[model samples]
Target: MLDAGLLVPTAATGLYQRSGDFEDAVRAVEAWAGSLRLDAYPRRSLPPILPRADFLQTDYLRSFPDLAGIVSVFTGGDAEHRALLEDLDAGGNGSTVLEPAETVLSSAVCHSVYPTLDPAIPDEGLRLEASGFAFRHEPSLDPVRMQSFRMLEHVCVGTPAQAEAHRDVWLPRMAEGLGSLGLDVRIEAANDPFFGRVGRMLAANQQQASLKHELVVDIHDEKPTAIGSTNYHEDHFSVLFDLTTPDGNLAHSGCAAFGLERIALALLSRHGLEPGHWPTEVRRELG
Candidate 1:
């Protein structure tokens, strides 16, 4: 259960009345940030919603057009009423429209990250861990299926080896960090939320290439939910952001993100809401 705010509540919402596990998730992100050893992070603040056009270049819109937002502009009452009639008629006719209005709404936290993956990140590479509120206008109201949520991400810009090594190194670190709290975990292949024709082709190629992965955790006492993902965007962001390497070649990129509320659900579903009442060891670890 969730409030209208869609946050795990201390009173009426999901299992836990306290958010220790949620706090631990934050701790996990902070600890991961400490491990990066980078000097400065290019701080970013997301606009209410970026132009759908900017997102198109990232191919996020093309890949997952279903995730795109539909907009209709009206000149006056007649135009508005006509547009409404047309929409109703279209729906009744059961016809699909390959619509291209604005770009697409950002469905994730790092939507602004790529544009900042500067071409000149110097020799060592760029590393930053960020956390923020993210919105996606998908139709999900299950406490687990939230329309808005928090996302924490680590953006990496470097060579392919560095990019791969980045995830290979941190994936286990994150898993180990969570495991210390008694969670079971695994690293598995993943697929994207690609759109129609063009997106289908790109997603197929990405899947075959094994470019994306998720750190699936058995959050519940039963089956698991993907609490986190480690994705390699093999020069996709580099091209879009104009990110470059030592010789000024397009740099490869990757990101690891954590879905905050899902982890809370995991804790409650697995350990129960009265986690503080659990055994000393579990309580201590999460604390």
Candidate 2:
């Protein structure tokens, strides 16, 4: 029988603990990441928790203000704590103080990679492999819409043609990679959730320019979830970080990111509770 508690929803909405077959599905996702051998010289590094100033430079705040996760620490000393305790003891609600920290939790896996580069790309280009936890504020009851999740991304930086070509090649491969695991996948043009009224224009331009594409699969309802995305950022990061090609032209960049938890949820939702009974190819690939 399928355990009802496979994914334990936490008190915080959109957060979940993976257990039972859910964990097994995530293991399968790890194997999928390992199977990709496209990098000629992949720059592997630990994920970064970025300084607030660094994150501020990105258009993240402008585009995703509602979803950004700020890191803060309690600024209260013992005296303040005692005052709150006394207030609570006297039947009043306790109050706490929190101050913004120097850093914010990572919102995207590739956000920090560009700043760490050598400032100039080689003639061939650059490829990077990064994996880490990321935070967002899309609170929901759906297990697939996790507020916190693990992500694996392959980033490419070079000329415009090079960056576009890399996404072209990988988009199909990513769909195949997930489909092999028995998940139904589709690739479609999409746009970022740029904030506010002006954001509508930005999103329209983004789609018109064909800057982003997403691989989606049905998880919870008829509305499909975007499990992966391929983005062609034309000089967006290059201008921000002053990145350049060997010949001094502005560099373009692209990335393919896999949402590990969403992939796991899709697998369990489609294949049922038993990982052992998953497709033979998927079991062998995961093993």
C-alpha local distance difference test of each model: 0.64, 0.82
Q: Model 1, range 1-287, lDDT digits (tens) per residue? A: 23422245443232233245455544544444344433566544454355566676776656665655544343346665666668777774312322444533457767666664556866877877666655555554356655556667777788888888877876777677656655677887878867777777877888789887776776445566787787887887787877888886888878877776666566555665545555566556555
Worst 10 residues of 1 by lDDT: 9-18
Q: What is the TM-score of each candidate against the true structure?
A: 0.72, 0.89
True-vs-predicted CA distance for residue 177, candidate 1, Å: 1.7
For model 1 the local lDDT of residue 70 reads 44
Could you tell me the C-alpha RMSD of candidate 2 in Å? 2.8
RMSD of each predicted structure: 6.1, 2.8
Worst 10 residues of 2 by lDDT: 39-48
Local error of candidate 1 at residue 61 (angstroms) = 1.5
